[model samples]
Target: MSKDFYTQFILPYAGIIIKICRAYTDSEEDFQDYYQEVCLQLWKSRENFKGDSKWSTWVYRISLNVSLSLLKKDKKVNKKSVELPNLDAGAPQDPNPFNDESLKLLYLAIKELSELDRAIILLYLEENSYQEIAEIMGLSPNNIGVKITRIKKKLKTLLDGKIY
Candidate 1:
């Protein structure tokens, strides 16, 4: 049953997991940890799924929540300084599908955002509608719209006015 669930549900949504993990982590090791934790939480909570939202939406919510939880725990455990990504370093040390400089810069900028803002932007970037994003984020559709606009402006300022 676990194997079937993994293949049928988790594998199909690995990209969503990866994106959320990358946004929440600073290093390859941390990224791997976040990814594993997200998958584990999803599997553990498999029976809790109620089909109230799409499978993809559930995956997004779980992935984001797991990443945020782990990030908070890590911060409390060790107050470490964040290292900015060296854009001129070419490809990242980790296996990242988003290796382009622009994408890397965008992610770096996103990392500077507040947790909720980061989640909102990530969901928006995934092309989730405001309504769907609200559903996953437990926000009202109107709130999601306003938050997305504000998040985008924050990101642009972070990117030195570059519209990502």
Candidate 2:
């Protein structure tokens, strides 16, 4: 990717990509791999973008799909311990709601969700409307609503330590 494109297009949206990656990855190494692969795939698939949706939405779809694919491959190859790194290492210390300790716990809880539910909750947290999430995930808006409700309950249970 050209510097101009990287600066103008990818960098502006890198945070969203990173958040999606972090949601799916257990370790910083895996997160870096997913982030790089997502950037490469974004460039490779740029031609397929037909202005049907906002560019960020397209990026979100690609990032989520790439992370889930890598995760599935990892699971098939290694059924033992996944060996996730310390979650705090290398994480930005910036004082944002998403970076706070409670939110970090929320992310750890999110990581326990099934891949599709992880993607859905990440999109919802990003403030995407249910219609937009449905469009991205190829599900009906009503289905997205129902899934969001269930996912929220799941997250609550996970955070409350009610679920093993």
* TM-score, per-candidate, Cα-based: 0.87, 0.87
Q: Cα lDDT of model 1 overall? A: 0.82
Q: On a 0 to 100 scale, what is the lDDT of residue 39 in model 1?
A: 84
Q: What is candidate 1's lDDT per residue for 63-131, written digit by digit as tens? A: 999998998999899845466433234222335556677887899898899999999899999899999
- Model 2 over residues 91-133: C-alpha lDDT tens digits? 3322353545677788879888998999999999989999999
Find the 10 residues in a row with the least total lDDT in model 1.
85-94
Candidate 1: residue 5 lDDT (0-100): 83
List residue ranges in candidate 2 displaced over 4 A: 79-99, 161-164
The whole-model C-alpha lDDT of candidate 2 against the native structure comes to: 0.82
